[model samples]
Target chain A: MADKLLITSSPHIRAAKTVRSIMLDVVIALVPASVAAVVFFGVKAFGVLAASTISAVLAEYLYEKAVKRPVTVGDLSAVVTGLLLGLTLPPAVPLYVPVVGSAFAIVVAKQVFGGLGTNFVNPALAGRAFVLAAWPLHVTSAWLNPLTMDAATGATPLHAFKGGQAAGSLVDLLIGNRLGSLGETSAIAILLGGAYLLMRGVIDYRIPVAYLGTLGLGVFIFGKPGALFQGDPLRGILLGGAMLGAFFMATDYVTSPVTPKGRTYMGIGAGLITLLIRYWGDYPEGVTYAILLMNLATPLIDKFVVPRYYGYAHDVAARRKANRAGGELS
Target chain B: MQFISILLAGVLTSNFIFMQYLGLCAFVGLSEQFETAIGMSGAVIFVMTFASTVAAAFEQFILVPFGLEYLRTIAYILVIAAFVQLVEIFLKKTAPSLYKALGIYLPLITTNCAVLGAAMLNVKNQYGILWGTVNGLAGALGWSLAIVIFAGIRERWKFMNIPEVLKGFPLALISTGLMSLGFLGFSGLFKTILK
Candidate 1:
């Protein structure tokens, strides 16, 4: 006999990758956008970023310590969430805003459920949502002009566009030369980070593709003020937080649907809701709430949209045939 | 249109669970199973309707008559506690299965803030008995809709690969927040309609 076979459970094939490494890749991918934000908004952006990331990590460490759970700061998910939250804020937010938001993200959003992988929604987004509700004026009215770093008080590009006014030029919009959320203004930087994630195999492609495609289609059909098929689809796709959310937030593995079909539906549903809010609702931007809504639906999507197990089709067919024969006899 | 507006505001726009954040204990704790949620909701609807009617009648007839307007809280609690006792005893004798399924939750409804909130809100809104009862029924319906939908979602959440920390109540709270975001869409619906 072949020398005693070494049998173990499945998963014989394994990679050297770990959660720490994957989270590191995400952090690395986010760097370009953070850099872009710093470049555009100057030192204020850096302050917000540091405050958020530090408070997020601190919140996680402190919570775990107090609760006697093992500290998870080493994994760096909180850091990523903090960085993402920082990036979403207006560059000129009061420093305490990021701190409060980070605490909310880690303590309330992440650690309260279980700690890390158990969180059902994106912590940063939940934090943002909370503070947004708590202080709507600060969240909505704190936009700053890029490069100039002046407190520019005006509606964002999406808002202006919604009101039938033209926004920035395509180049300006693409290159972080617009007034919007800190990380969301630079389409080029977001694309760079998104592309890196896609190439690194850190994220599934179905979600971003389905999300952007549906959003583009939706805007093309219904984005214009009065006419169908006359809307600026490129503008719709390139604007405010769509790129950031589709690539970064919606792709958070813990909160997203696992199956390919389910992920696709998640993306499309988010995109549809985003366009619905952007077009017909009061909000000028809808990406945050859209992704949050889809995150809520992820479990439902996974439950219903499971991929067929290898032998399930045959089993189903056999059962159906047996039932048909029984019916004929009856 | 006015009645429809009231119905919409109660059921969707100013939803008791999502917007007003009423009855959250039952919404969060008992919303784990769809059947359990339905049972809890049915019991709430029964309790809230009757409680609001009785509370309204008491406030309108007795409390406000003398100088005991400040006794609303005490009187309301007594009324709710008595009504819940009647429900518990009646269910235990007539519908033992439901009584068992409800278990402690039947009596727990006595402390449910939504019941008290509905009664107080009816008083605050100063509606007559008919509208007071309608508001009570509608508020309960809204709570039922929210908890039942959340229960269905939580059932699916069981099979998901949730992280450790966000597994239970924290995750439930976050999910509630997201559902509230969805309901936030209805904020201006009645504003535009009734304008």
Candidate 2:
């Protein structure tokens, strides 16, 4: 005989498809990048990871407790936030930086806006944004090169572009030997990570393809930078965390658009922002802000871009007439 | 008297949600309803105060002296996070009804930027442990006060007719800006206090 039935909500969908499971998928998706992080940033990547993950988990735990609520630290969302925050930040950022970033991500962006799905912006991105604003020098100043850091540092491909390093080779940018943020350096690793996520169904092609395509198209014609479409389209995708953001972060299901056209618009908007920032704005690589600004517009996009359910939109006259043809419902 | 500075600084001069704009998501998202907003604010204050004290002590005693300051941020975070979890468990087990009231709101606290902000500010300001605790407590209270006030305004806004363009986030952001500017009026008081 079946075990005594435990009753709950209609549909009885297994709650097993939980935030924990999704976060695990994200972790698995990030494995390649984590390995790349180790290869490039050395043991320091581990330090950043450990600090971020631990702080995130702990903060999540304590937060659930003090309010006399159920403990949710075990869900590993905090760990995910911590890890992502760490990945976004420079390797040399102070240890507490990740801790603080993780805490902000989980508590401020994720928890306060209503736990889990309710957050308006991606928590990890928000956390990094806060740190970038508060501690700009700490976050931006420590631009350690992969194999080394010195005169080589002021050599960000974008820097070279802006400062007349436009002649800088695409090969250096792709392999990530140039000066930049830790995990963002290796184009190859980020691309591999994106491919893995795409394969695992962690993301769809709309955001990445749209964002990358739009940015590439935008910069190819207008601005002066290293390797526009004229040189190597692939290099532009690899130089920064563009692939990572396009595939994983910007495409976060909860924080991103739902409908096909809406996500396309989302990608277009993000791409425009990235191009604008990279070409004209102070920062050479503009993945972070691009993703963030798009995140803010997600709800707006959703309002105008609801998916067509069967023949609903096509027979809109019939549906609206049925609901409100005779009498006002509201 | 020094404690008074801590209070004013947290509440006005460097207010958590408004002036510093730390936990903006909750400030905007939760303020749509007053009761829930107040409850959340209360949780933030309680957690922020304790977390600050714990973090400062850990830094001053454990991380700093050992020349492991590089690890202080992570360590402090772990301590604060773990403490939040432990507290959640104890409260849930010992006080079920109270836990239910705070159940949903509790998890929100773990990731609240205001809490982390208070702890970080305590360090940045170079406050001793006692002062740090005071600062954290005051920061949370200040955030609570700010959120409650904003929540009231938003509730009233629900009834008031608004322009189509400035109805939702735009209006809320504008309101927050006004509040932030209003708080700006208090910055001088810190100078006065220091003088």
Candidate 3:
């Protein structure tokens, strides 16, 4: 009779969602941008994606096996990380770049810190940062023209945008017909993916909304060289990796803040840093570094931005007064 | 404008801990808890600010006048050590609570490379007393920001299932390296604007 009755801890009722399911949803949400990347950048982009994804999975499997831990490759977190890293790269980067980048992401960034959830920074962004630092020339100037697949000789649209010149037509920018990173060119594809994530409740709306909103507002005020409130905010969000970073990278579960208010602060911080780097710094794009910096601040945000207890809905002063009076509320 | 640029450079672009790689001993040692990190930061700020001013004065009145430039490092060290001792004595007499909070870290600042480095930088850049003090304050503030943020991160690691081989310094240094990478965005931040 004792064996027939089952007992468990207080959280006996569990949600059906597992880590694998959530990761699978993320992968599904990324499908639109992935498809758009291949369509625009052609075969080299596809190769880059494949190499990074495969190496990330292989790296995780090998590291876990070597360390005598149970292999977690089946969870598909590695796939999402690898694919995201691949998407952030230029379409014309050397094949070894993605291979090395994804391996570093999985081993050093993810596993060395005790695997996925325990990692302090976003693994994909860390990988991108590592490879960028290692091979700055390849990462920065390896842009390929969409459809033509020819190496782009001129500065990226983001560079031209910084000079207060129009970066191609608004239509081209929206459809990803301009030169840029593999996954950052298409505004429509990224927005579609972001919408899917938002609709499925996989990501909170506050972060993306706050991030893009802050950036848009900032551009409107200070985007032009010698003017205020005359800058083009539409082209601002559509160009470069701002869209990609806002939707996919900044919204990562482990590296971002857990509390709602903390997430909003994270978004605002990332947006401001992006503007600072883009407008004043030497870097042509700031989204990667912006998100990475905010990832570093996530712990501090969580430490300070705690949620209020449900029963104690009043202000802290009132709660303290009640406590001092030694009386229970009727 | 120059003051603002130098201040911004010290705090952000050329941060002593993250970018310039100075004063790592105290950075790694006292970053275990947020409270202690804050304490060390206050002591360093005080020491560094005064140390820079005194060192600059010594450089101008003693070293430059006597053509004793070769004794810059030794002279700066002596001055900084003396200044830290004075601070220790003053804090103990005036603010016992603050003195107690600083604890052993008060004396340890005497050997901190960032303090010496700040003085040397001011001499190298030919900054006078006031500017040297500002640089020192800015550098210490940046160092404090890094350690405080890092302490917060390390506090969270208490709950993490970190592996045995990579427990303390290995993981700490690795995280620091990653953070430095993020700070790299500010590398040439002053290029177009300030120049």
Off by over 4 Å in 1: A1-17, A226-229, A279-282, A313-330, B1-8, B38-141, B149-186
DockQ score for model 2:
0.02
Interface RMSD for all numbered candidates: 4.0, 13.2, 1.0
Work out the iRMS of candidate 3.
Answer: 1.0
The DockQ scores of all candidates, in the order shown, are: 0.20, 0.02, 0.78
Predict model 1's lDDT versus the native: 0.81
RMSD in angstroms, candidate 1?
8.0
Pairs of residues clashing in candidate 3 = none
The candidate that wins on DockQ is 3
lDDT of 3: 0.87
- Per-residue alpha-carbon lDDT of candidate 3 for residues A235-269, written as tens digits (9 for 90 to 100): 88888799999999999988888778888999999
Q: For residues A1-330, what per-residue lDDT tens digits would candidate 1 score against the true structure?
A: 111211232221121125667789899999989999999999999999999999999999898889876566776788999999998898888889999999998987767666776566788888887777777788887888899999998788888776667987999989989988889999999999989999999889999999999999998887777788887888888887899999999998877877677889989998988886677556667788888878767655655565655566745554445334322221
Off by over 4 Å in 2: A1-13, A149-153, A164-172, A225-233, A314-330, B1-195
Worst 10 residues of 2 chain A by lDDT: A321-330
- Separately for all candidates shown, the number of backbone clashes (residues 3 or more apart, or on different chains) is 12, 17, 0
Candidate 2 at residue B12, lDDT? 63
Ranked candidates (lDDT, high to low): 3, 1, 2
